[model samples]
Each structure stands twice: as C-alpha cells, then as structure tokens.
Target: MKLQLRLSEWQLTQLRQQEQNLQEEETYLVTALNERRLPMGSSSESIARRLTTTGAGVRAVQAQASRQLDQVRAENRRVKHLEQIARAAAAARLRDAEARALEEMTNLHAGRRDRTATTGWLDSKE
Candidate 1:
C-alpha cells in the first residue's frame, strides 16, 4: 500500500507538470496566432494549425491529469480499506488468543482442585 500510494502521488505530480508545460505551450501558440505580421516563410494557415494543435495537446494533458487524479483517489481509498481490514483481523486474532488463554487457565485451576480433593494436601500425599 505504501508503494502504491507513493507511485500514485508521483504520477499525479508528473501529470500536473505536464499540464503546466502544455499551458505554457498553448499560451505561446495563441500569442503567435494573434500576431498580424507573417514571420519569414510561415503562413497564417500554418500559425492557425499550430494554435489548434496546441489546444488539442492541452486538452489531452488535462484529460490525462484528470485520470491520474482519479487513480490517486482510488489508491487512497483502497489503502484505507485494506488498513481497516487488517486492523479488524488483528483484533479478532487477539480476542481468540485471549479466550484460549483464559480457557487454559481455568482448566489448570480445575485440575489442581480435583487433585487436592482426591488427596488431601494436609495428608501430605498430594
């Protein structure tokens, strides 16, 4: 669980970093598209295409980030559930062990009582 949680967190961090980078790329592309002058050999059509492609890239990263976030939440919930199960199991085992110990103690004392009754301790033949 610890390893899974750490991996999920790492993936989320990576997705966030990707999103930030995509945002910067989209911003730069939008700025370029808004320019009036056509740079060197680049045409307006090419600039528009770049902006569209950047928008698509941004959307893809956002979707990926959303998926990663969901995975993280699931991993967290799963870990908590597993922990609860482990705790319950441990508590049950402890209860069983205690019950057994109590039973053994009762039997031991009962045997001593029987033995003492059969041969009186005051008679020194026990």
Candidate 2:
C-alpha cells in the first residue's frame, strides 16, 4: 500500500492563518511578560506563588512558540531555495536554446562568405 498526503489550497491558506495567529500570540505573551515584571508591592505568599506560576507558564509558552516560529522560517527558507534552483535551471535552459540557435545561424551563414572574395580581388587591383 502507498499513501500520499498533501494540503489543498484552502488548507495551505488555513495554515498560513494559523501561523499568523501563533506569531500574534507570541508577541502578546512577550508584551505581557514585560508588563508583569515591574514591582507589584509586597503581597501575601499565596499571591506571590500564583504570580510566579503564571510567569513560568507564560515563559514556557513563549519558548514553544519561538521554536515553532523558527521551524516555519526554516521551511520557508528551504522552499525559497528550491524555487531559486528551479528558476536558475529554467534560465540555463533558455540560454542553451539561444546559444544553439546562434550556432545554427552562424553555420548557415558560413558558406555565404564567398562574397568577400570580390572585395579581395578589388583590393588587389587597387
């Protein structure tokens, strides 16, 4: 048995939307972390512990989101690289075709140089 899996255009669009959401969430988390770092004045031990736990949870999420973003960026780089390679190959093929056409034209004109022999004769007479 063989299996092939690929995302449809709609699915790809959805994935892009999800990626944007993740980026937004990560940004919000970082902003929240920054805001929470300031002195909140002396509080009871339970409140302090809750704040600490919340902070730790935010940090973990930030780390995971950052990692996921890194992965997405890496995949984008790879896709871009493959696109570049394909473009270069296409350009190379075009160049090769043009070169062949030029070579063929040159060969076709090779036998027409006999007209220059008249000029040589005129030069000798002068």
Candidate 3:
C-alpha cells in the first residue's frame, strides 16, 4: 500500500504566502540598511533623523517577520516528518497482512495434504 502525503489547500496557500512575505521583508531590510550606509551629509542627515525615529519600529517588524517565517518552516518540517512516519507505519501493516495471508494459505494446503494421505492409507487397507 502506497501512502500519499496530503496537505490542505489552505495550509499550502498559507505557507506560500508566509514565504513570500519573508522574502519581501528581507529585501526591504537590505535596502534600508544600504541607505543608512551612504556618506553623511546635510541632505542625508534629514533622512537619517527620520530613520532614527522609526528605526526601532522597523527593526521590531523585521524581527517579528523573521520569527514568523521560522515558525512556518518548523511547522512544515513537522508535518512532513509526521507524514513519513505514517507511510512507514502503513507499509509495516501491509507487510504484516501479507505474512498472515501466506501463513493461512500454507496451513490450508498442509491440511488438505494430510487428509489425502489418510484417505490413501485407508484405501490401501481395504
């Protein structure tokens, strides 16, 4: 018996969205960091001042997004791991069932053979 891994449509969609959001946020962080590294000037000071005011908030958002991404990845891994275990268990059950069936077939054949031998002995005596 082949066991298939099944994921709900919503779960797949959510995972995709989470991945996309993480990528986008990572890009935004890189851009912001680059902007902050430019040569300091009066023009840059205004931008720097604004960045300084909102930097903590931006950092917090990035951290939260990263944490969420990690959580989603962990969940996906957990689900896949569980699926592997289920497949292995199903395979084991199938093998057990086949063994039992073979044992029963062998016992049935042996019983028939014994009956035939007994009948043959009685016929010879007669």
Candidate 4:
C-alpha cells in the first residue's frame, strides 16, 4: 500500500507563502529605510527611530518565518522517513506471507499419494 506523507500539500504551500510574505515584508522595510535615508526632507531623528524600529520588526518577523519553515521541513522529513519505514515493513510482511504459503503448498504436494508408488506395489504383489 502506498502511504501518503502526513504533511499535506496545502500545508506546505501555506508555509512557502508565509516565507515569501516575510521576505516581501523585509524588502519593503529595507526599501522604505533606503528611501527615507535619502535627503527627501524626512530624515528627521524621530522618523529615523521609527524606521529603525520597523526594520527591526521586519527582521524579527523574517526570523520567525525562517524558523517556522525550518520546523515544517523537518517535520516533513521525519514523516517521510516514517512512511518509508512502514512501507519496508509492509513489504517484508508480504514476503514472509508468500514464503509461508509456498512452503505450505510444497508440504501439501509432498504428502499426496504418488501414482508410481501405488502401481509399483500392486505389480510386486501380482
């Protein structure tokens, strides 16, 4: 039996989307910082502090997303490993069952009466 991994495709897609969103957010934050850094009359100290804080927030979120993605990937790998082990065990069980059936058939045929044995005994008696 083919076993599906525990991690669903939708879940993986969501994780990837979250990672992408985090990267986009980081890019937006950096772009905003760069635009503000230019002497466009908004390089005031308070604005600089606010942008720094926002940048820090973006970094934090990106780090969290990276961690989540790593965890999800690790869980997927673990589940895949377990599925492989289960499949191997199932195959081994099937092989064992087939071997047992073949052994039984061999034994059954060996126990059956042979026509040669019966005819030879009758011929000797005659």
Candidate 5:
C-alpha cells in the first residue's frame, strides 16, 4: 500500500501568496524603520507631534509584521518537513517494488530451470 501526500493547486497557490505577503511585510518594516531613524529636531512642535504619532504607528506595525514573518517561517518549515517525509516514503515504496520484482524473476527462472531438467531426463529415457 502506498501512502499519498498530495497538495492541491489552490493550496500551493495560497502558500506562495503567504510567502509573498511575508516578504512584503518585511520590506515595509525595513522602510518604516528607516523613516523612524530620520531627524525630527528640524520640525516645528506640531510637526514633531505628528511625527511622533507616525513613529508610534510604525513601531506597532513593525511588531505585528515581525510576528507574522515568524509565523510564516514556521509554516514554511513545517511544509518542507512534510515534503521531505513524503519523498522518503515514495523512495522506500520504489525500493520495495524493485525488490519484489527481482524476487519474482528469480523464482520464475528457477521454475524454468526445473522444467528443462525434467524434460532432459524424460528425453534420456525415451
């Protein structure tokens, strides 16, 4: 019996999308971090206040993005591990099939040899 591990096309597509989303989130966080590091001293008080608000918002976004990236990485790892297991199972099945085939061939050859020997003995007595 073979164990099948199959992923649907839609499932694969969804996984690819999730990976893309993780990449986008990482890029967004990097850009936000750069913006946050920019100088705030040159701005007026009100502008500084706005910048502070924006900075806080960006920090929150960065935290969430980091968490999401971690989750995506974990999911990717799990999928890869599953794929490896499936491949190993498939290889084992192939090996088993080959071994069975070889054993059957050997048995067939032995049977043929026995028949030929019996025929030779009958001909000798005739």
Candidate 6:
C-alpha cells in the first residue's frame, strides 16, 4: 500500500510537471502569434493563408494543454484519495496497538494487592 501510494504521488508530480510544460508551450505559441507582423511585401492571399495556419496551430496547442491539465487534475485526485486511505489505516493500527497495550497493562496489574485496579473501579455504577 505504501509503495502504491508513493508511486501514485510520483506520477502525480510528473503529470503536473508535464502539464506545466504544455501550458508554457501554449503561452509561447500564443505570444508568438500575437506578436506576428504581416510581411510588408507579401501578397494578400499568402498573408491570409499564413494567418490561418498560425491560428490553427495556436488552437491545437491550447487544446492539448487543456487535455494535459485535466489529466493532472485526475492524478492529483488519486493521490489525495490514497493519502486519505493511508491516514485512516494508520489511525486504525494506532487504535489497535493502544487497545492491546491497555489489555496487557490490565493483565500485568491483575495480581497486585489493589483490587480496584483489577475490577476497573472507574467503571463502577457509583
């Protein structure tokens, strides 16, 4: 279980990093597209074709970045779920250990001269 959790966490980290990179790539593409200047001597038909192609490229990058972001969110959710389960399991183990220790202490003190300690005076009806 611990190993699985660690692996998932590592995967989540990798996914986030990948998503960041994609976002950076998208940003750069958008910036480049925005800053583009029409060539001074270009024919209008060529200029229109160039604008169409760059617009399509920017749209494709945006779509890919969004998809990567979704994957990162999913992985993040998985890591959080695994962490919650690990915490609950640890809590259960701790409770079990405490119960066992209490039982052992009771057994150890049973032979003592103190009767109240054995009978659990704290549990008395009074």
Local accuracy of candidate 5 as per-residue lDDT tens digits, 1-126: 011213333344455565566556555545545566433443344445554665565566566556655665666667789889999999999999999999999999999999999999999999
State each candidate's clash count: 0, 0, 0, 0, 0, 0
RMSD of 6: 9.3
lDDT of 6 by residue, 29-74 (tens): 4555466643466655665565566566656656665666666567
Winner by lDDT: 1
Q: Tell me the alpha-carbon RMSD of every candidate.
A: 3.2, 10.7, 7.3, 4.9, 8.8, 9.3
lDDT of each: 0.85, 0.60, 0.65, 0.67, 0.63, 0.66
Model 4, which residues run further than 4 Å from truth? 1-46, 114-126
Q: By TM-score, who's the top model here?
A: 1
Candidate 3, 43-115: lDDT as tens digits: 5555456556455555655666566566566666777888899999999999999999999999999999999
User: After TM-score superposition, what is the CA distance of residue 21 in candidate 5 from its true location, in Å?
Assistant: 16
Give the per-residue lDDT digits (tens) of candidate 2, residues 10-122. Answer: 34455556556655655554555556543356334544455566566556656665665565556666667877999999999999999999999887787566667777888
TM-score of model number 4: 0.59
Q: Taking the tens digit of each residue's C-alpha lDDT, what string does model 1 give over 29-108?
A: 66766766556787778878877887888789889889988989999999999999999999999999999999999999
List of clashing residue pairs for candidate 2? none
Ranking by lDDT: 1, 4, 6, 3, 5, 2
User: Least accurate stretch of 10 residues (summed lDDT) in model 6?
Assistant: 30-39
> Order of all candidates by TM-score, from best down to worst?
1, 5, 4, 3, 6, 2
Tell me each candidate's TM-score. Answer: 0.77, 0.45, 0.58, 0.59, 0.60, 0.56
